[model samples]
Each structure stands twice: as structure tokens, then as C-alpha cells.
Target: MVMNKALLAAVALATTMIIMMARPSVQESVYITNHLTKRVLIVHCRSTDTDLGAHAVAVGASFHWNFRENIFGGTFFWCKLAVEDKRIYFLAYDEYVETFGTWFVCDDGVYGTPASRPAFLKAAWTRP
Candidate 1:
């Protein structure tokens, strides 16, 4: 009886660990779509810990990245999208809350997806 109880407890612990390890999903990602009329989009993104570098996205293409949120919280990513001299900025992700968005729309300028409904930062470019 003692041996049986020990085996049962070991089995239970293994099951619990397996269930925790098999969680459906914990990773998160962001997608950036270019909706520009006819221009290539220059995209660059960064976080407190990493820079995604610059990418030239075709008029109808997209760029994306996947990452786990900071374990200690306070994960964030921001991006810049430029078309010719026009540019805009938006947060790609925010861990603390609904602070930023994961889906972005790049038309004449950049914006978080309509579902996000966040105020925007658009810049009209000129020689500086």
C-alpha cells in the first residue's frame, strides 16, 4: 500500500507538469500590413531590449514578429513607418495593459488597427 501511494503521487506530479508544459499558447506576436496606395513602406521597430531593424515592405505586403512578453511585466514595442517623406509612429505591443496594439495599418501613414482606437502620431516630412 505504501509503494502504491508513492507511485500514484509521482504520477500525479508528472501529469501536472505535463499539463503546464502543454499550455495551448503563451507566445504573442505583432503583424504590420502595408496599405499604401503605390509606395513601399519603410518599417523599423524596437523595444526596450531589442531593435527589429529596418525593412522595406512592399505596397501590399506585411512584416511581423513573435515574442514572449517580459516575465516581470512592462514589455513594450514601438514602430516607425515611412512612405516617401511621410511618417508615423505607433506602439506594437504593451504588456502592462491594452497600452498598445499588435495589428497595424500602414496607409499614407502608420496607425494602429481600427479596433485599437488609439490616438495617433503622424508626421509630415520635410528637409530638417
Candidate 2:
């Protein structure tokens, strides 16, 4: 009986590890930074049909968000920034790619132009 219990326990442990390894990982994130010297940035992030809401990021501050692909096999996010009562908008779309991982938004003192691109950091860490 003791030997049988040990074998069963080993099998269960092996099965659990295999299942964990075979599962698809979800690691996605969006990072937005306000690089303005004095202006506060009010950002609105949303999908095509759903409104995810808005966030206020102070100067030199950053915002990070984690998201998954939509049920339609793609993900689209539009961001609008309000600075000094002026509104500027940008869009990030991912259809073939799995995740965006990280992005950066910076103001270069150019009106109506906010520099946006992927970050230099590594991809987002995965979770079980």
C-alpha cells in the first residue's frame, strides 16, 4: 500500500507539471509616460465598442496597463491625451501580434505631437 501511494503521488506531480508547462502564457502590458515639464496629461484608453475610462498622469509620471486579446482575435486601444485644455489622440492596434508588452508616450514640447513607441525594457513577465 505504501509503494502504491508513492507511485500515485509521483504520477500526480508529473501530470501537474506537464499541464502547467503546456498552458499558454498571458503576458501583455502597456506603459504610458507623461514627459511634459508642467502640464498634466489626462489619458483616455478604450476599445472600439467599450470605454475603459480615463487616467490622469502628472508630469514625469507613467501609467501601466495589462490587457488580453479580445474575443475577435485582435486588440485595439485608442488613447486621447488632454494637455493644457488641448486634446491629442493616438491609436495602438494589434492583430497578428500576440501582445504589445510595453509602450512609451512622451511629450517633446511639440504641440499636438506626443512621441509614442515601444519601450526598451523586456517583455512582460508571465503568470500561471
Candidate 3:
């Protein structure tokens, strides 16, 4: 009976581990930084299923949020960015590729950066 109990406990532990591993990340995070010079960068993000709301990031500061993904499929987040009169859009996250972490940013802090980089990041935020 003791041997049987040990065996059952081992099985339960193995099954719990498997379930935990198989499940998608319960909490994932994304970060956005404002590389714009002396400008308050405006960031608004959303998924097909969720609206992450808008944020105003001070220069040299970073904005971030956390959430779970739809592990089944089509898990992605997109963002809208603006500085002064110029505004653009970009992809903040793609679960399939895990394209970036703390993205939509540059240390350069130059205007018209988006024009050169395919708007927002293409493969990044600012999708076509």
C-alpha cells in the first residue's frame, strides 16, 4: 500500500508539471520606450480581443504593460504612436515570432525614424 501511494504521488506530480508546461504563459509583458527627443511619446496598444489603453511616456522613459496571450492562436498586439503632429502605428508583439521585447524604440531619438524604418517597425509596430 505504501509503494502504491508513492507511485500515485509521483504520477500526480508528473501530471501537474506536464499541465503547467503545456499551458501558455500566464503573464507576459511588453515595454515601449520613447526615444523621441524632448517629446512626450503617446502610445496606444490593442489586440484583436483587448484594448490596452493609451499611455504618455516622457522622453527617456519607458512604458509597459502585462497580460496573458491567447495560446490557441492569433495572439498579437499593435500600437499607435504619436509625437507632436506626427503619428504612426506599429506591431508591439507577435506571439508566433516573439518578435521583440521592450520594443518600438531606439537609442537614437531621431525624428523621421519611422520613415526610414518602414513606419513603426513593419516587422515591428507600424505595420503596413
List, residue by residue over 68-123, the lDDT tens digit for candidate 2: 55533556777776676565665544557443434444453212222374344322
Alpha-carbon runs more than 4 Å astray in model 2: 1-25, 97-101, 109-128
lDDT of 1 at 90: 62
| Counted clashes in each candidate structure | 0, 0, 6
- The 0-to-1 C-alpha lDDT of every candidate, in the order given, reads 0.70, 0.60, 0.68
Q: Which stretches of candidate 3 lie over 4 Å from their true place?
A: 1-21, 104-128
Indicate whether candidate 1 or candidate 2 has the larger lDDT.
1
| lDDT (Cα) of model 3 | 0.68
Residue 128 accuracy (lDDT) in model 1: 24
Better of 1 and 3 by lDDT: 1
**Count of backbone collisions within predicted model 3:** 6
Which pairs of residues clash in candidate 1, taking residues 3 or more apart in a chain or in different chains? none
Off by over 4 Å in 1: 1-25, 99-108, 114-128
**Model 1, residue 18: displacement in angstroms?**
17
The most accurate candidate by lDDT is 1
- Cα RMSD of all models vs. native, in order, equals 6.8, 11.5, 8.0
What tens digits encode model 3's per-residue C-alpha lDDT throughout 1-128? 25788899999999888876798676887777776656788789999989978888997888888888775567888888867666676667788873555664543322222222443334323323
TM-score of 3: 0.63
Best to worst by TM-score, what's the order? Answer: 1, 3, 2
